[model samples]
Target: MNYTAMLHTHTLAWFLMLILFIVTVILLKSGKAKGGKIVQMTLRLFYIFVLVTGATLLIWNFYWATGVKAILAVALIFTMEQLSTGIKKDTLQGSRPMVLWTQFIILVIIVIYFGYFVA
Candidate 1:
């Protein structure tokens, strides 16, 4: 039961991911925001905050990560890059919304799996 504030870390990670998902949905729904810079700036700041928390947790608190979980994390990062490229260019030639949600769900499953199994 000794987690060293592990519950808080998991909660933060989940909460961050949820917020990230919602922000992305908003951006997608806005359809490039019709040249509005507000959404763009908001997204930029959100990305920085997300990366800060993600990197900090990765560095400060080691997770007994499984192969599935590790791969999913890498995949999530890759997805983020693809998403950024699409957002910046306002183009999505091949990506689909469903594919992203599927990947996101898988990542969430792995996170929950790790949360319960690793500790």
Candidate 2:
């Protein structure tokens, strides 16, 4: 696929992933582990989509800033996965979830900046 198409796909995947992440967290918080797990599994598929598209874009256009953005994007994905798992397992002690959420948000901003403006 062309770069434009790939970029659009990547954007759409991340958008859907964000929505699914919110839903999964809400379900888990509401004591609906089964439903949350199902959504979480679906969310994982979107993660794969985002990673694949992003990787394709990077391969098509390699640059130092883009490389950094890719790394940050991966970190953002990892943070989301960890936060959801922590919520599901009830392992997030006080402030732990908050910290992860903060990291996730910051990484998102940085990644967006690099993806859009820098790169």
Candidate 3:
């Protein structure tokens, strides 16, 4: 919590991001992962929103995306976009749960790196 630092990745942004993730978690838990088109579209919208916000964060919070963390950060963002597209057409490369788990892990790491390293 350095008082002098200015940032857009503050509590509110992360909270909104968390809400996006949580909505996905709930959808999956509802067995909506295989739900009708509406559910799938809702989930996709959530993912797209998350991806967009992530890119916005990367742009505005460029200070965080440096060193090895920089590469990881970009890869994470790309993966989100890839995932969103994959799910859009239901042509993901592997197991659905696996992708969801991997996405969760990536988000966790990005959040950690952003909070501790970027600042």
Candidate 4:
């Protein structure tokens, strides 16, 4: 596919992933493990989509700055995954989830900045 189309797909995938992440967290917090797990699984698929399209975009652009954005994107994904897992397992107590959430937000901001303005 062309760069424009690929970029749109990547954006859409990450948008949906973000929505699903919110839904999953809500469900988990509401004591609906089954529903949360289902949504979490869907979110994981979007994570794959985001990663694949992101890699494609990086391959097309192939710059050091884009590489930095890609790394930040990966880190963002890792934070999301870890946060969700901690929520599911009831391990992220007190300020732990807050810390992860903070990391997620910061990484997302950095990635978006690099993606839209820098790269």
List all candidate RMSDs to the true structure.
Answer: 4.6, 0.9, 5.7, 1.0
Model 3 Cα lDDT, one tens digit per residue, 1-119: 23223334344444554455455445544556554335545545654554555555456556634334545644554554455445545566658748755875776677566557664
Question: How should the candidates be ordered by lDDT, best one leading?
Answer: 4, 2, 1, 3
Cα lDDT tens digits for candidate 1, 24-117 = 6566667755443454455556555555554555656556564445556557655655555565566665556557667767776776677567
Per-residue error for 3 in candidate 1, Å, reads 6.0
Report lDDT (CA) for all predictions. Answer: 0.57, 0.94, 0.52, 0.94
Off by over 4 Å in 3: 1-5, 8-11, 24-65, 95-100, 103-107, 110-114, 117-119
lDDT tens per residue, model 2, 14-89: 8999999999999999999899999999999999999999999999999999899999999999999999999999
- Per-prediction TM-score to the true structure, in the order listed: 0.54, 0.96, 0.45, 0.96
Cα lDDT, model 3, residue 90: 59
- How high a TM-score does candidate 3 get? 0.45
lDDT (10s digit) by residue, model 4, range 29-115: 999999999999999999999999999999989999999999999999999999999989999878888899999999989998998
Model 2 residue 92 CA deviation (Å) reads: 0.9
Comparing 1 and 2 on lDDT, the stronger one: 2
| Residue 96 accuracy (lDDT) in model 2 | 94
Q: What would the C-alpha RMSD of candidate 3 be, to one decimal place?
A: 5.7
